[model samples]
Target: MKIVATPIQGVYLVETTPFQDERGSFYRAFCDRELDSLLQGETICQVNVSRTEAVGAIRGLHFQYPPHAEMKLIRCLKGRVWDVAVDLRQDSSTFLKCYQAELSADNAYMMVIPQGCAHGFQVLEAGSELLYLHTAYYEPKSEGGIRYSDPKLNISWPLKVTDVSTRDSSHPLLSEDFRGVVL
Candidate 1:
């Protein structure tokens, strides 16, 4: 695993080298020692798998506040997506800035999103599946979100958004007084 830092503090892009042969290929998706430097004492407490059936589906720009904030390592298992992370750390230099990467089975890459960052993805192909390793468990009361089309974010999604849940669509746009999350 090759971990590269992103402009946003604590965020990383992980690349996995696959060993290929006639019988397909193999690669280590996660290695505790390899990521020890980044994870510190944090251990993955939850694993999530999501399969989106339609292209142009938008999932988030979501995070948990304070005590429930999570660190997520996301990888594409099938098809492709345009993954996005927005820095929401109030004290960080890159606060409100966004980073993007193309994640797909073919790329064998993952995006490591730290606590205080809002994460979301736009499906680039039909039937896209994603695997996620999260450092914190889900807490509905701590859930928070920003609208996918929030003017303050200025996210450049690659495709026309075709689907979004009512919950996501209902997330309020960032206001002028927004101060970001304190990690």
Candidate 2:
């Protein structure tokens, strides 16, 4: 696996090297030796998967607060998506900055989102699946989000959003007092 850095601190774009043969292809999706420098001492403790059924569906602009902050390594499993990450590290130079990458099964790419960032995705096909490796487990009390359409972030989604969950749509727009998370 080859790791590439993004404009935002601690975010990475990873390309997993795959070997193809007459039958199929084989690749190591994750390797501790190759990624240990980026991972620091964090270990994967949980894995999650999501399947979206509608093209243009939006999933989140979500993250957790400190005590429960998580580092996420996410990849597309079945289809394509416009995956996004927004940096919210309070003391960082790129606070509130957004970064995007196209992830699909064919691409074999993963996005590594650090603890103080919000993550979301827009489905580009009728059926899309994603796999997530998380450094921290879910904690409901630490859950937080910003509206996907928040004017402050102004995310230019690749497609016209066709569906969104009530919970996601209801996330408040970033307020003036918003100071970002301290990881």
Candidate 3:
């Protein structure tokens, strides 16, 4: 496995080489030794799976406030998605900047999203499944989200965006005074 940094400081693109044969393939999804330094002693505390049924469905742009803030390692387990992360760390050079990649089961790539960043994805294939490893547990009171279509971020999703949950679409646009989250 190899970890490559993206434009955003804490965000990373994790690459894995899967051994393929006539019958199947196998690869290490996570190796603590290779990733421990980046994790900074934090351990994954929760694991979640999401399945999006529509080809153009959008699932988030979500994060949590400090105290419940999470670091996510996400990968497409089945099908494909246009994964995205937005840097929302206060005083960071790349605040509000976007980093995106096409994650697919075939590629075996994962996106490492640190705390203070918003995460979301657009389903590129129907029935796309994503597995997430998080360093923090979910907290309703600390939950936060920004509109996927927020003009301030202007995310260029790969598809027509055929489906979106009411909760996600309801997130307010970034305000002029929005300073950013401090991790």
TM-score, per-candidate, Cα-based? 0.98, 0.98, 0.99
Clash pairs for candidate 1: none
lDDT of 3 by residue, 52-164 (tens): 99999998899999999999999899999999999999999999999999999999999999999999999999899999999999999999999999988989998998999
Overall lDDT per candidate, in order of appearance: 0.95, 0.93, 0.95
Write one digit per residue (lDDT tens) for candidate 2, span 26-123.
Answer: 77878877889888999999999999999999999999998999999999989999999999899899999999999999899999999999999999
Tens digits of per-residue lDDT for model 1, 14-85: 999889999998999999899999898999999999999989999998999989999999999999999999
Instruction: For candidate 2, report its TM-score.
Output: 0.98
Query: Which pairs of residues have clashing backbones in candidate 3?
Result: none
| Residue 156 CA displacement from its true place in model 3, Å | 1.1
Error of 2 at 178 (Å): 0.5
lDDT of 2 at 5: 93
RMSD of 3: 0.6
Model 1 global lDDT (CA atoms, 0 to 1): 0.95
Worst 10 residues of 1 by lDDT: 2-11
